[model samples]
Target: MTDNPTTERKGHCLCGAVKITAKQAPSHVGTCHCNMCRRWGSGPFMELDCGTDVAIEGEENVTIYPSSDWAERAFCKICGTHLLYRLKGSGEHMVCAGIFGDIDGLEFTSQVFIDEKPAYYSFAEDTKNMTGAELFAMVQAQQESD
Candidate 1:
């Protein structure tokens, strides 16, 4: 498993109406336990940080929803397959891991909104966890540094 974004990865929606291409799909997976994520997927959202270099074919077959002030979610309109969770300003996509069949070095490494995670379920993997406030602060700090 690699810690860095190395190779290109491609995947499509359930109905094959839409395709996602990531120029640098990271091997690391980040889990989101925020309320919005859980409500969207019925559980934590496991995603790959596919940086800004992403292409979405069949744009006409997809739907985009502004989930928050800083981010938006997209899905295949044909099959309702979740496609992306992207940052507004950077246009950085954290694509749905489920869409990708099997990636070589994918591994669970981090998690956010841990405080909102319910007690009914837990992941066996050890991950770097951060609360909602911590996550927001971290992002803010990163943006400031940039």
Candidate 2:
């Protein structure tokens, strides 16, 4: 139930066209409520930050969209399943949370683009919620510090 660096997790696209393996358990699991994410998945996009320790088995079947100046959204080209959201600056990969079947011990820690989250739905878990602007500023500050 902890974020263990040595743990490995495996998953595949809906059509099994692309397989993914992460060398470490995610440090964070988060939900994104931005318009782009909502439109992409018909709801808030839940994801696991797999960092740089992820490997793709069928990269040729993956397509990437430059969703923003700082990030790109990737998906399985064949089945149209969302694959990963990647940071352009750091190359960090946030894989779709549902892709990994029967995973345990992952924690839901935060939500981003909170200002855009629809009022019709809410999560009961108390999580750190960050507005789009706040998230961007925090990311920028982190990059600058790095």
Candidate 3:
């Protein structure tokens, strides 16, 4: 992650019901092309690993869905804007990159579940792509280490 201890980035949901603040700029930005992510956002879900340094303002307006045993997804109840995808085991929150008002230095570095990506749509940027199994293994290893 970049040393961004001084930057405090702010953002809000579509209806302005849920506001969020990140204490530092994201170190890495990535896309998930898994079926669940594609269905949830109608495309690859782009996100930034904000670690645990995020603050939410409209907690009451946020609804969370347990998308998997290992993860849960959160969205703004009013506008249905996807807010975050959190790892249940580690409590790592990957906030939707699209919601951030300032994305000046974030770099799209990876794409997960790449095997499930549709043929019709593709990104021009060369990224580190991992299949679903590879992604799961990486997460599992991380959880074990923690």
Estimate the Cα RMSD of every predicted model relative to the unseen true structure. Answer: 1.2, 1.9, 2.3
Model 3 earns a TM-score of 0.90
Better of 1 and 3 by TM-score: 1
TM-score of 2: 0.91
Each model's lDDT: 0.92, 0.88, 0.87
lDDT of 3 at 54: 85
lDDT per residue (tens digit) for residues 51-86 in model 2: 888999999999999988989999999999998999
By lDDT, highest first, what's the ranking? Answer: 1, 2, 3
Better of 1 and 3 by lDDT: 1
lDDT of 1 by residue, 1-146 (tens): 34575678899999999998898888898999999999999999999989899999999999999999989999998999999999999989999988986677788999999999999999998889999999999999998999
lDDT string for model 3 (12-127, tens) is: 89999999887764657889999999999999999888877889999999999999998999999999999999988667788899888887877778999999999989998888
Top-down TM-score ranking: 1, 2, 3
Stretches > 4 Å off in candidate 1: none
Model 2 steric clash pairs: none
